[model samples]
Target chain A: MDITDNKENMTEAPVLLSVRGLVKSFDGKTVLDGIDLDVRQGEVVVIVGPSGCGKSTLLRCINALEPIQGGEVLLDGQKIEKDGKNLTAIRQKIGMVFQSYDLFPHLTVLDNITLAPQKVQKRPRREAEEEAISLLKRVGLEGKAGSYPRELSGGQKQRVAIVRALILHPEVMLFDEVTAALDPEMVREVLDVILQLARQGRTMLIVTHEMQFARAIADRVIFLDEGHVLEDLPPERFFTEPGTERAKNFLHMFEFEAVR
Target chain B: MPDLGLNVLLKGKNMQRLLSGLWTAMRISLIAVAISMPLGILLGVLMTKKNPVVRAVLRVYLEFIRIMPQMVLLFLVFFGTTGAFGWNLSGELSSIIVFSLWGTAEMSDLVRGALISIPKHQYESSEALGLSRSQTFAYVIIPQTVRRLIPLSINLITRMIKTTSLVLMIGVVEVLKVAQQIIEANRMASPNAAFGIYLTVFLLYFIVCWPISMLARRLEKKWKD
Candidate 1:
């Protein structure tokens, strides 16, 4: 299987997740206005925008974490709704990692990873523990499974958080700035884990500020401004030949920061 | 002048009566706690519900309990209920009923605060992990809420114990009422008995409440981590 061939086929790939005319509002103020997006299986879609542009809210709406005021999110062509009876089933297929690494403070890393599997999936405790250890080892956290979230550094906590989501074997993962809260040095370890997942052909929708990482990993980059998609293109074209002035100015700021 | 009241307190049957009165007070508080704890937790969880009607009703109930004096509540339940409804409410039962009402209101508020204080991310993360609402509460929300509530609830427990002395006003013959009886009996023989008996009552309350407050403080420190 040629890597370039797979990339070429992405345009016609079957959609694993689809967002149609998604709208969200908080206290009568719209945060996400008529947004649309799609993620093909094993494809990486990165969303970039300035602060408060509704980037995070879009990811939350996709997972049904936020109630949408209008439109629908479909996973494998099935509607995701706030009041859906099978929300847990729908959510099981879409794992999310938060920026703060919301690991259960009372639970150890291993327990945190294994909790959903044992409790929701009804997997045996021993089986869940074995799988958790393997996933932990994959992230180079094999020895830290016994540590609490507070005892770990920001990077370690985020890695464990990613592993916690991965153990559920979600078909698509939503990463909401998983590195935003980390120190400069710690961001790499967490990003490396995510990059490794991308290498393993995981379907990921990421909202990130790391322009370089977004450029490196994204098959398609979406530029959002003021709750609307300003541009959606391949990273190469998005960086060099942005179609809109809004996107161009956005990229120009990053370029100026890079030189400084 | 030389602490004659102390002798009256140690006289024939006065000490025994006080001990029994203390027993009555302790028993009433324990029963009230046992009933209120589960009831309060349920109400607290209910208070977090999104339904406006339920919230409004619970809010009214909480405010009513908070604003009404516990002594007045005891009177209403004991004498008023008997007079109005013709129901036979024993003094001890009335004391339990009134305290349970007060305890439930206080406990529910503590629980609500604990539940709300949990960070929003905890719920979101649990939901994203595919845990059902019940699973989220049982495993994620409840554990954190319980840790936060234990110390506060323990403080409420001590408050309930101290407040049980109010039942004496309704003729329950609790420790304070027993002390009053002893003082009245020894008015001619032991002029200073009131001072001695009241001191003993204070010490008895302190003995019961001090350890509990200490325990709450220690727990608050331990769970802070």
Candidate 2:
């Protein structure tokens, strides 16, 4: 009922996702160096960092989008590897929404959202369509079922992309800068949809530069720099009294940027 | 009024010869198209593979096909191969083989381009949704690739049909050869027959290729959205 009671219950929820010592590198250049994280059920964790600080890479590694050179990722206690036999099964439980809103251009919005559910999950077509249409309606895209991705605006496409991930009923959702590519005016619309999801108590791991949105939505704000977590604190503390000097300077730059 | 020999198209067995000749040309081209489409798609998918050995092999094959002229390929297959390896090949079979090879090469390259042109996010998002590799190809990659390929592939088909005229040089009795025979046989009777008959042949080729070009343009416009 209250903020403290909700926070306490969220902590009491079982760990739905875990990352232990994740190390990723591209061309022998380390991007995620020995990272450890855990996300509880119905919790929302927002990760914020400077450009190229591995915030996106860390989310990608958890979903097994990028191969982890060292360390392991476990979803619901089952280890997820690059080519693991159960990779798809595990991935089906972790939904991802990208910055560019990569909806299938050839498919209608309804088909785009229902594709994985019908084909991979083997859900019945009518059932998938019903769920997809409901999700579309919830996102304020009620009449967009027959429309293709190209016909939708940037914010509309991003909302459809979110619904496309939601119909599968993923245990954890990963938002990789879902609004970073939008026009400034459209950014609020997409963020509002994400905030609505947050209110529904969806377990999400978000990588974003929207410090204000991050502070507002995050249960715990994580500060990553140079491919390591520097501060993991409540948004109130992380935004106000960051533990490290690097975080303080990062927030200062953001504030200066806001002024400009 | 003096006749320009246009009536030859309806003359005794001449109509039959011309129609059958056109079929001969189309037969070779259509067969080549049928075979090349699937082969090229497979090779195209393979072309995107990161394996160096596969890439090198396909690159060499594509380059070799591109370098040799189609006529030279026909001659090599029909004449040189018979002399060197002692395998007698007919003109129709030779034309089919040459055209198939050329079409396959061009098509695979088109396919590779189409596949690469797809944004990386498409595949990444599909994978993120837990779609298997095959499912991703079937639902996501292949459908979009097919859309991008349609207009280009239709252009390729028209080119192939036009290039079948080259098979007459290799002694294939295709439409061009039929027209030539009719012109020569009736040269004394219809001096104007050359203009009339060749005009008819031009119209025939136009009729076949124009609709295809129109379809391509229509789809390109429709999908441009």
lDDT of 1 at A155: 97
lDDT of 1 at B211: 95
lDDT by residue for model 2 (B1-225), tens: 767789766767886887788889999999999999999988998999999999999999999999998889999999998999999999999999999999999999999999999999888999999999899888988888888899999999999999999999999998889999998988887777777778888888999999999999999888774
DockQ of each: 0.69, 0.80
How would the docking of model 2 be graded?
A: medium
Best by TM-score: 2
RMSD of 1: 3.1
lDDT of 1 by residue, B53-144 (tens): 99999999999999999988999999999889998899999999999999999899998999999999999999999998899989998888
TM-score of every candidate relative to the true structure: 0.90, 0.93
The regions of model 2 sitting more than 4 angstroms off are: A1-5, A8-10, A257-260, B1-11, B222-225
